[model samples]
Structures are given as structure tokens and as C-alpha cells.
Target: MRKYSIIFIFIAFVCHFVTGQNKQLLYDFSEIPQSLLINPGTETDFQWYSGVPILSGISLQAGSSGISVNDLFANDGIDFNDKVRDRLINGMSPKDDLSGTYQIELINIGYRGAETDNFYSFGIYNEGDAIGYWFKDYAKLGFEGNADNLNNRFNLSHLKTRGEILNVFHFGVTKEIDNKLTFGVRGKLYSGIIDFTSTKNKGYFVTTEGQNNLLSNTLSADLELKSSGIITLDHVIDGDSSAGDMIKRGFFGGDLGLGVDLGFTYHLNEQTLITGSLLDLGFLYHSTDVLSYTLKGNATVEGVEIILPDAINDPNTDFWQDLVDDVEGLVPFEENRKSYITFRPTKLYGSLRYNFGETVQSKGRLDCDCNLSGGKSNRTKYANGVGGQLYVINRPRGPQAALSAFYQRRFGNIMAVKTTYTIDKYSFSNVGLGLNLQAGPINMYFMADNLLAYRNIAASNYASFQLGINIISWGKN
Candidate 1:
């Protein structure tokens, strides 16, 4: 009963958090400094900005393309076993997944270079990303024993998962090469803290008729799980080591890697523009505190032949013990301290935007505004904007994509709002909204998606939230 309860809890967690990595509401909103993290080439009008420590850039996103909490746990007055059978074991597919991403900026600062008229920014942040695909056949077999499921091949390849926690230190530069083209690039160093993965698995389990016995069971399996840094971290959590020990395992003190983000904004005319970016093209090598496991082989077993008279005389024969030993010899399970490498889940983003309404300049602004970037295009900051954006991220199974159309309104530098309608694998009517407000030198912003589900977070198939505070200056006008 306790094991069943734990299974139910795991089911609920996956239903609530399985989702893609998409932030359409904040992608191209130049009013928020975090947008630069997604598109470094995003056009900017600010002179300099600094985030409010850890509070400046905090975000969490979770969702699923399958069942919600209401399907099993809702007060629909249905039998719990029936719900599990119909909704999960029967309805869910192996392709359905559980996933989520979260990020927190530790220090972010950006300033325009007085000598080069370029924008130079640098920051450090902690990020976590994870994903696990559903295993329908495995779940079905576990719920209903094979005694009732003969000749059914239960897939062992359905189990797939990978998760990691790491710190990223980055530096970027945005330069306007010409009036029509502005481009940027960010270099990154990744320091991994904890990681685990087991994606490539194969084989199956089947029970079939036997000539000599009542049944013959066969199992074939090829599976592996890999990890790094979890051993010492567990010790720290158990009070055997200081927290600083784990901190040292992060921030360039652990498994290290390199990557980069490239982006550009191209002006079609004056009001129409196109933008695109590619992020996290890097890989990590896990050599320290590494551990991995593997199970690979095939086995078949049949109960001992019980001749009516002989079985009555040999009741002490250990048939089950013999079967276990035979299976263990056929399918060997082993563990090793071997190192491996993992590539970062690269992401792609692109957008087309059209600016409208009259230019609205507020506060300290030069009459022409060209002085800001040493011939930075005197393009106007329109009061309104409409755009379409597409996002894609690499996953263990494949690439997941999302499309969005948005409308933005701004009241000079005081306040700005962006609303979006997005369509993705999880939800079609996903509405996202964001607000950015600037009061004197203080800047703050908040963004969220799946507003329809905000009324019932538990019943939601997808949800996301982001907020931050920062300080800014337009330079001494």
C-alpha cells in the first residue's frame, strides 16, 4: 500500500511538471534585461543596467501534453484503481514526458562601452534542467502482473531520463555594425554540480506458453545509468561536510565546459525587423565523482516438470531458487566508476516584428538620439509593436517547438506591457502576459503563462512564472 502511494505521488508530479522550455512572453521584450539572456542582439535603448542580485532574474516553467491532476486525484468520485488503469496505464504513451527548467541569476550587469559605443554585459547564474519520458508498458506490467498478461512484450526501452544542476558564467557584447544589422555573441563557461542520466535503453520482457511447463518467461535487457558529483553532495546533505564544500564543487570548481550564444537583429526597413538566436552550443565532461551502472543480456526460464508421482515425493525441490540463479547468470548487472560527456541542450529562437505608432521619447533624451551609440540608428521607439516568434529546444527524444504571436504597448520608459497567444504541444490557448515598470532608477518586471490555469494550478496542464528587479541609468544626459 505504501509503495502504491509513492507511485501515485510520482504520477502526480510528472503530470504537473512535464513541459517544454519556452519563454515567449519575455523573449524579445527589450524593456526587461533578462530578455538579453535569450537574444543578446535584442535592440536596447538603455544606457546601463544592473540586476538586484538573486531577485533580478528568477524563472520556473512546468507543463505537460498529457493528463492533468484532475484526471486521477480530482473529486470525481471514481475508484482510484480505475482511474490509474484508464488514465495512465491505458491513456498515456511512451512519448509523453515529464520535464521542467529553472534559472536564477546571481549577478547581472550591463553597461555601454564609452570607448566603443558597444554594449558589454556579464553575469553568473545557476540553472537546472530535467526531463523523463513516460514508460507505459512498464507501468502497465507493474500494475497488473504478467499472470494475467501472457505473450505480451513489455518494453524496457521506455525508461528515459536526464537531469542536471550547474552554474554558468557568461560575458557578452552587442555591437551595431551598421544601421540595418546589429549582432551580438555571448561566451559561457559551465560548471556542473550534480547530474544523472539514463536515456539509451533496449530490450523487453515476455511470458509465453511452454511445452514442458505451464509457462515460459523471457527477459532481454540493455540499460545504463550515469551520474557525477551526487556522492559527495549526499554526504554534505547528511551533515558530514560543510555547505562550502559543495559550493566549491560549483562555480568553476567542478566539471567544466564551454559554450556560446549568437544572435542578430536585422532591420528590413525602419519599422519591420527580423531576429534570431542560437544558444548553449557546448558540452560537459564528467570525470570527478563519477559512477555508472549497466545491465545487459537475455534470459529464459520455465518451471520444473512436475511428474504427478515424482512431485509428491520431492516437495522440497527449490524450483524458484534455481530459476532465480539461472536468470542472474544469463543477465548480468554491473556498476563501474567510468566518466562520460554530456552535450548541452541547445536552443533556437527567431522572430519577426513590426513597429507602429509615433515615436515616444521620455525623460533625458537628445533631440536626435544618435549620440547614444556613435551613429546608433536614430530609429524611433514606437508606442506599439506586434510580432511572431518561434522557439525550439533539443531534448533526449527530439526537438520540441512552440510558436507565439504577441502584441506590445509601451508608455515611454515608464511602463511596458506585452501579451501573447502561443500554440505548442502542451496547450493551444496558452495566454502569456508580462509587465515592466521603471520608477526613477529602479526597474522591475513580471511575466507568466497559462493564465487560464492560474485559477486552478493543480488542474493545469502547463504553467510558468518569471519576475525580476533591477536598477538602470540612461547615462548623464
Candidate 2:
């Protein structure tokens, strides 16, 4: 039973994060109020905007690199066991990951500061992100008892995972330096609700021929799992805790941290613009309700070597127990209450767009709407724009990047449409579409990614969508 503990933990850890934080559809989508969340420097034409409370902004993205549900449970006639054996235990690699991210805005509102001529934006939102790398070697060792395969070292380092849920309160000031440059900076306060990580584990287990016994099992293991706010969350789940307390924990009654975001937009020429933003460049400090599991050191056991006075034929189980106890002492599993710091998964977004076609008339005005200051110039709003965008996020394995090219079209001042084709590690043929509509002072926008995969979502690797509604004032007479 002691020998099975290592592999059991690995099998459990492989179970789960999803589509990541690549919001290509909403990166530079100035039509939606939430685009500011991704790029605070996003050019805003509205004089002021207020989201529709909790219903204002919502986003979710989920995906896996190695296998989809259809691979195992498709209607095809392959045997279920065989599919699992081939697709899961055999075909998957260490780099393959299942990860996801989600966000819900609670309060989003912005206004133009009259004194400084700067746009001020602030909001609070709940976010959760998780990622887990597939444990290939451990799955193989568990599925196929390592009796036949000698000298094959099953890596303990294949286990890498992290997850967190927190709320962020942020305020930003976007300033247009000149007609050619616009920049913004946002400060963030993080209230962590729950978090866990087991990303930097290292070691291995190998079975080799022994001189005194038929086999020698050796394990070189260094592993640790750190968690914060899990105890309270567990209590809440078991009905032993109040929901209000949990919400309080999510609102700075628990752990706390700080972060900042920076973004900028630069117009190289009248028809060209370069834009980018860096998000979540900060860390969380967790001290309360922290629990950690650690398994370190090394141990080796050659079968169950035991000797008794009754003779070798009838061995005392206590002697075997003694051997197990000795081995366990050499490599102990421990529980600890220690503080930790977890860095937020940082993301980068950049794009270069070309504006063209006819210049649209300003809302209710063919001439300049107001005085030209704060980077508001006589520059025209083109009816068509084309661009390519790049999105990258720091992952446990490495930085993953996606590239997309889009075409945007505007219909007068009432509606806008954008279509994109993106290529990433998950899919090469992912396509996205977005729409922004305006009816008087009401603003609504929707963006969907991997639209082609909608035909059979289960077969696709990644898909996501974002939508929001807000009231806006352009300050036009």
C-alpha cells in the first residue's frame, strides 16, 4: 500500500485549467466598454460610459492541447478502453496542458476628467485561472504495472499545476499625450479567495535489478503543494461556513496583493496605428488559512525483506511492517502551515492596424464636435480597418502565443463588424467574429472566438466568447 502512494497522487493531479487568456476578439475592440480591461490605452471616443452592473461584462475561455472529449467518447466504433489507452496514456506528452480563465465584472464605469482632460476608468471584477500539465509518465506507470519495463524512470517532475480565484479592484487614467500617442496606467488591488500550486516538483522513481532480491524500487522525490484559503472554502462547501464570510474573504477579508497594468497606442501615420498592453504584472501574498503538503528526500526498498525466528517460510507481518516503516522514515510526507506568494499569470497583447476607406461623419456633426485637445484632433474615423494581432501569456511550461489577422468594417456611426483568422498551438483554422451596436446612448457588443468550431464544439480544441452592455455619452450636442 505504501508503494502505491506516489502514483496515486499523480493520477489525481492530472484531472484538471482551460482556453487561456487570449482575448484576440476583444483586444483592441474600442466598441465595447470591457475592452479597456484588456487594454486600458484603448482609444475611447465616448465621453462617459457605465456598465450594466453584473450583466455588463463576462468572458470565459477553455481548451486543451493534447486531447478533446471527442477523442475519447466520440460516436466512432473504437473500444473505450483502447481509446483511453492510446489517446490518454500513450499519445499525451508532458507539455500538453488543460487550462482555462474566466472573468465577471461587478462594477464598471468610466468618465472623462474635465480638469486634466484625461479619461478615468475604474471597476471591480472576479477572476479565476487554472492550469494543469498532463502527467504522462505517471499515468503510464499507473496503468501498466512497471514489472515488464525495467530501468524506466517515471519522472515525478511531470506534475505541474496551479489555480486561483480572486477579485480585483482597479482604477486607471488614460491620457492622450498628443494626436499621435495615447497611453494609460492602471493600479490593481487583489483580494484572494482561494489558491493552490504544485508547479516546481522534481524527482523520479525507477525499478532496477537487485542483487539480494528480484527487484529494487528506488524513489527520488521532491514535491510540495501549497494552498491558501482552502480550509475556509472547504468549510463553506460542507455547509459548515457562511456564504457571507466567503464573499467577505473574496473582498479583502482574506489575503491581499497589488499589481499594475500598462498600455499604449501610437499612431505612426494617419492610416497606421500600433498598440499594445501588459496585464497582471503582479503577485499575491498569502498568509492566513495556508496549508502545504510536502514530500521530499529519497528512499529505496528491495521487495519486502523481513526475517523472523519462525523461519523464512512463515514470516512475521510485523517484520515487513518494520521494513515499510524504515523506508517511510527515509522519505517522509509532511503537512505544514506556511505563507507563500503566487505571481499572477502575466499577458501581453499587441497589434498594428491600417485604417482606410471613406471617413465617416461625426455623430450629429460633420465638422469638429468639440475643441481639439487631449489628443482629440481633426483626424477622421475611417469606415474600414485591417490589422494583425499577437497575444502571449506566461504559462507554467513556457510562453504561449497566438497570431491573428482581422478586418473591421463600420456602418456609419451605428454599428461595427470585425472578422479574424487566428493560429495558435491548439488550432490553425480558428476564426472569430465581433459586433458592436449603438442605439442612442445605449452600447452593446458581442465577440465570439473559434466560430468554425461551433459545428462540433466537443471536437474543437479552444473556444470562447465575451459580451457586454453599457450606457455611453459622447459629449456631442
* lDDT by residue for model 2 (1-477), tens: 432353234323323432257888888877777888889898777678899998788888877888988999899999999999999989899999887877889999998788444789999999888888888888989999789779999999999988888899999988877777889999999999878889999999999998689889989999999988777866765678987877998888999999999999888887899999999999999987998999998988887665455556765457677787887788889999989999999999999999889887666212353323324554567889999999999988889999999999999879999999999888898899999999998988888989998899888888788888899887764
Report the C-alpha lDDT of model 1 over 1-477, residue by residue, as the tens digit: 564455335434533352336889888898788888898897676688999999999998886666778788998899999998998888888888767878889999998887544788899998878787888888988899799889999999998888777899999998877777889899999999877788899999999998678799889999998988767666665668778876886776778888999999988877888999999989889888887899899988786555678778888877778677777888988889888999898999999999888676744322254422335555567789999999999988899899999999998879999999999877898999999999999999999999987787777778888999999887774
**Which candidate's TM-score is highest?**
2
* lDDT for position 382 in model 1: 77
Cα lDDT listed for each candidate = 0.83, 0.84
lDDT of 2: 0.84
**Range of the 10 consecutive residues with the lowest summed lDDT in candidate 2:** 364-373
Total clashing pairs for each candidate:
2, 8
Give stretches of model 2 more than 4 Å off: 1-19, 306-318, 364-376
Give lDDT for model 1. 0.83
lDDT score at residue 212, model 1, on the 0-100 scale = 78
